[model samples]
Target: MTATAEPRVLKHQALRAQLETLLDGMSVGDPFPAERELAERYNVSRETVRQALRAVLLEGRIERRGRTTVVAQSKVVQPLMIGSYTEAALADGRSASRILVGLTQHTADAELAAALRIAPGAPIAQLERVLTTDGYRVGLETTRLPADRYPGMLDNFDHTSSLYAAIMARGIDFERTEETIDTTLPDAREAALLTVDARTPMFLLNRISYDQNDIPIEHRRSLYRGDRMTFTTTLRAG
Candidate 1:
């Protein structure tokens, strides 16, 4: 890169770090300064300020709400583990709740049956819900399981409680899971559920859980607000 371009990039990065440090002290409801004001304060062009804002926004440090940009907390970090969403939120020292969208039984189709290793047309339970923290919607989770695997699972499960406990009650223990994450802009349905713009970026997690016997017991597809959720992966030196 040219020396000219290098300085410009470094200046932008420095401004972003400055903005982030400023935001770290503010509470969630605190309003951010106007772009022009921020530019003047940072002694940068409005365009530079915008670029810095874009960097922080992509990092999920703050978000625009309605007509105003406000401070939001750092993304809720979700470690790869076999735990309920509530547990994940609590681990971050936040309260977690959910709004149940629906729970119903359906006949498992070819793909669903294969995924669960069940007979075709077997009964399956589909549960859809939104996960929230501090009264703000952050994610939509949809999970499916073979109904026969956990008889009367819906009838016995509390809608607001930990899914891990619910499954354990039915003697279905989940020992491990494989999860894959991908990114997309929220569609209309997802946007409405998450209370974000349709063009808002998001992460979609597809997790398949297995039992002690290595049998797939559940399939879950969760769409999380990219601006308010972050995922963590652990690595060890070999």
Candidate 2:
């Protein structure tokens, strides 16, 4: 005799499909029907509705608000390139803003020296900023520049403005950037700044931006809240 699918499994699958059908044509922020109503409409138990919603939540298809759920906003699309969240948010029709947290002089460590192509212990200019989209704080960006390459950067670059804008204003042409992406749990301070639970994971991205001569001009590490972004990359066959 063939093994049979359990009744619970079949019911849950049917309920999940029913919920997806109900979600059709809904606006991104539109609230999902209340659990009681969903249970009655779908002829399933409240637990069944919760089970269905769990799958959707994991897929980032919807998000839970206080006492309810809503269709999630589309994930931010990021092509692999030299860019900033400030620019990316605007491209997606969202307002981007920056808050300069700190700016100071620092000495390069072994890792920074290699990425910035500066001698270890050389003086470097460091800047930190928080990036927000429509008031939702999404990323913390920390950047360093070899002080010798961009003298007076502390005074010349407007920390509140776009970092790329300031570098270009100083006549340094930005040619390209290389980046590495990873993920990890937010630190205590990062969790507080991001208003997320301490266990919330974040996207950690490091970049080395180069000038026309292939000289590295900037080295940056940006930590992004995982809930708000979905990085996308495209690959083509050779």
Candidate 3:
């Protein structure tokens, strides 16, 4: 059974390579060839073509649109560094904007308290927004800050603008940040907000930003669509 499976795997891999080559010549949003046509051109069975196409789809080289598949737009590359989403999008030659979702004040729970190093019942200002790049919804972000530390933040801060800029305007600055990244699938509400399938994979980012005195000033949780964005970093050899 193992021997039989190996050849099938190799065949699909080879077919996937050919499909990628085909995609290289196509422009973004160009219609991908039908499976029947691909099978005929490659002299393979339709099932083999289907398997190859599935692999390509998973790689984000192509996407399903209604009843057709088309070449996908290049994923936005976000550097894993201290920067604002607007700054990163501008660097990529894309326009960035945000839709204000909600803004409210709440008392910090035990989990939030530990993360921000504040009292469990301390007043916290929570801001939620949907991030967009080039008019496409790409991420959702929720940011929490100590309400007492940033007085009038809920009323003065513009939810649609860069949060970092607003913080700087208040004479507050980020000295450093600690961030973690993981993968998750969106819930139904999140999927509807991001305009993605509920099964779509997402990049979950949690960050804690600190002041010059190493005090945690901000806690942020963000979710970015895996198909529309990617994270990059530079590593130095020690």
Clashing pairs in 1: none
In candidate 3, stretches whose alpha carbon ends up further than 4 angstroms from where it belongs are 1-11, 33-51
Q: Point out the worst 10-residue segment of candidate 1 by lDDT.
A: 1-10
TM-score order of candidates, best first? 3, 1, 2
lDDT of 2 by residue, 124-227 (tens): 98898887777767788898889888777678566656778777877878898888889988899887777665655688998898998899988898898776
**RMSD of candidate 2 to the true fold?**
4.4
After superposition, candidate 1 runs with Cα above 4 Å error: 1-15, 21-25, 36-50, 236-238
**Candidate structures ordered by lDDT, highest first:** 3, 1, 2
Best-performing candidate as measured by lDDT: 3
Candidate 3 local lDDT, residue 171? 81
Better of 1 and 2 by TM-score: 1
Error of 1 at 79 (Å): 1.3
lDDT of 1 at 235: 86
User: Distance from true position, residue 121, model 2, in Å?
Assistant: 1.4
lDDT of 3 by residue, 1-238 (tens): 3465443557778999999999999999899999889999999999999889877876778876657889988778899887689998998899999999899989999999999999999999999999999877889999999999988766966777888988877787789999999999999999988977787789999999998789998999999988788899999999
